[model samples]
Target: MGETFTGASDPKTARIMAFGDLFKAASHRMLGFAGLAIALGGLGGLIVMLNAKPEERLLPDPDLTPGAVVDVSLEEMCEPGYAARVRSVDSSERKQAFRMYGLSNVDRRDYELDHLIPLSLGGSNDIKNIWPESRITKPWNAEVKDTLEDVLHREVCAGRERLGNAQWAIRTHWIQAYRMYVGSEPERFVAHSRPGF
Candidate 1:
């Protein structure tokens, strides 16, 4: 259930090859009904893609993680070390997050189990608020999002932005939020956490 003889590298490629194999096997068994099997093979490709739900494309997969937030007031959220005090994602929850994203046999470092709304903005650590953010996904990876989180937290803490609005913006379409709030130059914000924790 891995790579085929043709050496289809990625999982998607491997699955497509597997579909071809299935079509061939069916053709062998059904004799004259090879065309029908080929048709089904095409359909199977769509099914494989549907099964492979990505954690995010441009925005988040709203179905899997729409973001959840705990009841923390402005003062608490703005307080120093607030995110650190509230931040907690145990191993079991992390594993559950992986399963939710249809990921298995993956290196944890390859993905960041990201909080869609982010703890800094009073986002909940509930499983519903989390998703496996691909570290490899360009221009919108976890690190990129972290910048937005930091920016939003600052805005919220400074009374420049509403907590709910900030949360909603990030939760719904962080890419847009990045533009709306963090501005075009997000690289400057990277690796710079708001001190204390």
Candidate 2:
């Protein structure tokens, strides 16, 4: 029965045999791919083992600490439309404007603080960081201007972190002022109303 079709197989039998061969070839290719994947994985593991330090390998990058405050500068705070206001402006205003209208420190400075990141945004209240500018200019200040960018670009930079302590302090003072003047709900206190670059 097997010898009967040895010389010339039927078309149906030939087709079936061809399909079986193709199936075997496909299975071999799949197994080859899996083996290659495993080999590459092992090689990668070996490479990592050879070069990686024990502390550096399993642990996250030590330099990459979380919640680190991004550094900003006062000169970087000033944009074309933005200007620093006198830090004293908040305390010096006439009673009519501050007491009656309930003006923000930035507003009292004519939106100068808005041209810079408000103390509310973790910015400082020093003269370098604070500026008195018009309300139209407030929209242009960068909320988080990078001093590093200026330095990297080799621009003439000034007063790095000079205002940080003052800024932080003034921000606290501003929060207190808001609570005193605006009766809390201090989120309504608008310091960053202007555009910053």
Candidate 3:
């Protein structure tokens, strides 16, 4: 992971470049990456990064998106409207995310710049905590994840679930986490899809 790349001389881009953008912006910039250790995402009963294709990868690389968060009391995190009050991801950051995923020309409707761990769970708006979750993909798209997020938020606020576990679920395998917490059809959805379950 010590091996790194440099990116657009712009100070901001330097901080935002990711694997796809590194390749897509080859003519213009690069960025450094560390913590190559990956968290698992599953498909078809096996853990892999978005079907295991690097260029086609859909989920955030744990090395790039480790789900940043800030320390907050459960009460603070669980307050109604808390996520809305704290949520903030600018347009430029959204562009950065699409570029980071090598999605320069994709239809905006096809994706949502999303938080890995939701703001409701104390997730930060840091570039490192966000990714372009698909709006089109089925069985494991952003909408489905939203259901899981709401469930987790309720669980955490209810004192029935630990905040850390909710955070961990988003980072590791949400599909699996969904089974345990969301009480949905396991067969209809699953993917360690960036630690779903």
Predicted candidate 3 versus true structure: per-residue lDDT over 80-180, tens digit per residue: 88999988999998888788765687698988888988989888898888988887765567787787788778767877656766676555555445555
Please provide TM-scores, in order, for all candidate models, with all chains considered together.
Answer: 0.67, 0.18, 0.65
Models ranked on TM-score: 1, 3, 2
lDDT of 1: 0.65
Please give the CA lDDT of all the candidate structures: 0.65, 0.30, 0.62
As for TM-score, the candidate ahead, 1 or 3, is 1
Name the candidate that leads on TM-score. Answer: 1
Per-residue lDDT tens digits for candidate 2, residues 1-197, read 01011211344234434433444454444445544655777757445443432212211111221111224443444433222332233544343223322234434544323313243223334333333323332212222122211221222123322333323212222222222222333232243322211
Q: What local lDDT score does residue 80 receive in model 1, on the 0 to 100 scale?
A: 90
Candidate 3: residue 67 lDDT (0-100): 69
Candidate 1 residue-wise lDDT, 46-65, digit = tens: 34433332222434455667
lDDT value, residue 136 of candidate 3 = 72
Off by over 4 Å in 3: 1-58, 184-197
Mind sharing the TM-score for model 3? 0.65
